[model samples]
Target: MNEPAQHMDVGAYALGVLDAAEAARFEEHLADCSRCAAELDSALGLTPLLADLKESAPDPGVLIARPRPALLDGLLARVVTVRRAQRTRRLCLAAAAGVLIVAGPLAGSSFTSQNAPSHSTVSAAKAMYEEGEKIGAVDPTTKVDASVSLQEKPWGTHVALKLANVRGPLTCDLVAVGRNGERQTVTTWAVPAAGYGLQGAGADKWSKEPLYTHGGAALNRNDIDRFEVRTLDGKLLDTIKV
Candidate 1:
């Protein structure tokens, strides 16, 4: 194969902004280029954290409403503080047009109802399942286990779900139900034959152990009365009362 000219595209390629032709060409080159491949690996390592930053951010409207008065003089200095604070916690990134929210070179963001990696996204969901306020249930009829985690934001809620004891191939959704009866889909995924969180599932089949999905809703946490785990065809599995 005639190799394309050796252009160092580790950064853009890592972030997946490369055009299809560029990505294809870079991928072919990557087959042999150890340095670029290694660099890509390191860059992809940030995907989880990046997804966390993007997924957990508060409402976008808040940012546009609060433009920085001293745009130039203080912006750069505030950036250092923001990064430092973000390293420690999710710093509510309102203003600066929510520059940090909309990713440009967004590496590894699957962005499906949303995702970054099959694993990394699930891992991030697991982290949210642990850290956020949560409620759960095991359905009597469906016998499916479901847990809903919620992190309240000014605009709405960030949602994560851990679903187990469910058999598939089945499609399922996490619906955030409001006190007024409004329903918003937080996230959805298809379950496989092996099912999730089945008894005796080995670490090797951990991916099938539980379905972890994350998404956001427009309803504030206080307004959400419950979460429903249901199928696309309207088969309800579990209802987690908040």
Candidate 2:
């Protein structure tokens, strides 16, 4: 599918309106397409609000033609209301996730399981430590501690990351580079403020998470030669050789 059509289907897929085959194809595409994944994530995150709107919204078939001004005003009001609700929900979710991350094992399991990571979390982290090659930050200004383990899975690479003594509200984009030099974005996420800790703190003091990126079916473990972490604007931050 072309980019435009793929983008268009993201909403349908998020709303669960796509048929089984179509949804499968889109998900396959989503594994490699970070842009569509981001859009779909946004739509899925707003699912509750979407459901509320669907339940409360009047059917167009039941509504008689109304004055143009009134119709326009009502539509604008609805849009504004939805936007406000979305912002509020996003803030709450972010705060909750941050709190869970900081509060340690007592609340960590539930949040980690729901978001990402699983029973394999510890093994993955250990594998990355013992086998993965260490990747250094390319930029002198940024403080990033990262490694990549290509042996963990046949499908994709696993990344162990730590951001320390750095400012927050920053985005970390993970890109996988093929042996042929083709690049595919694996994931992009915001590093929370609390993720960074004091310079002398132990690894446990710093927030460390294992990130998995399946660079689609085309790119496999052997195909990937390196992984990179960068800002959204394509600024080079760190690189790990497989």
lDDT of 1 by residue, 108-168 (tens): 1234325444544434567677789878899998899898888988889999888888888
Model 2 lDDT tens row, 1-242: 66677766765675565678888888888899998876666666645544444554477344332324444344435544665698899999999988754443324433555666655543333434455545544345565555444444555555544334444567777788889999887656665554543354443433443333222224767677877778797776677776
Q: Candidate 2 — what's its lDDT?
A: 0.57
Span of ten consecutive residues with least summed lDDT in model 2: 208-217
Each model's TM-score, in the order given?
0.49, 0.40
Candidate 2: where is the Cα deviation over 4 Å? 1-143, 152-154, 158-165, 194-198, 201-218
Q: CA shift at 223, candidate 2, in angstroms? A: 1.5
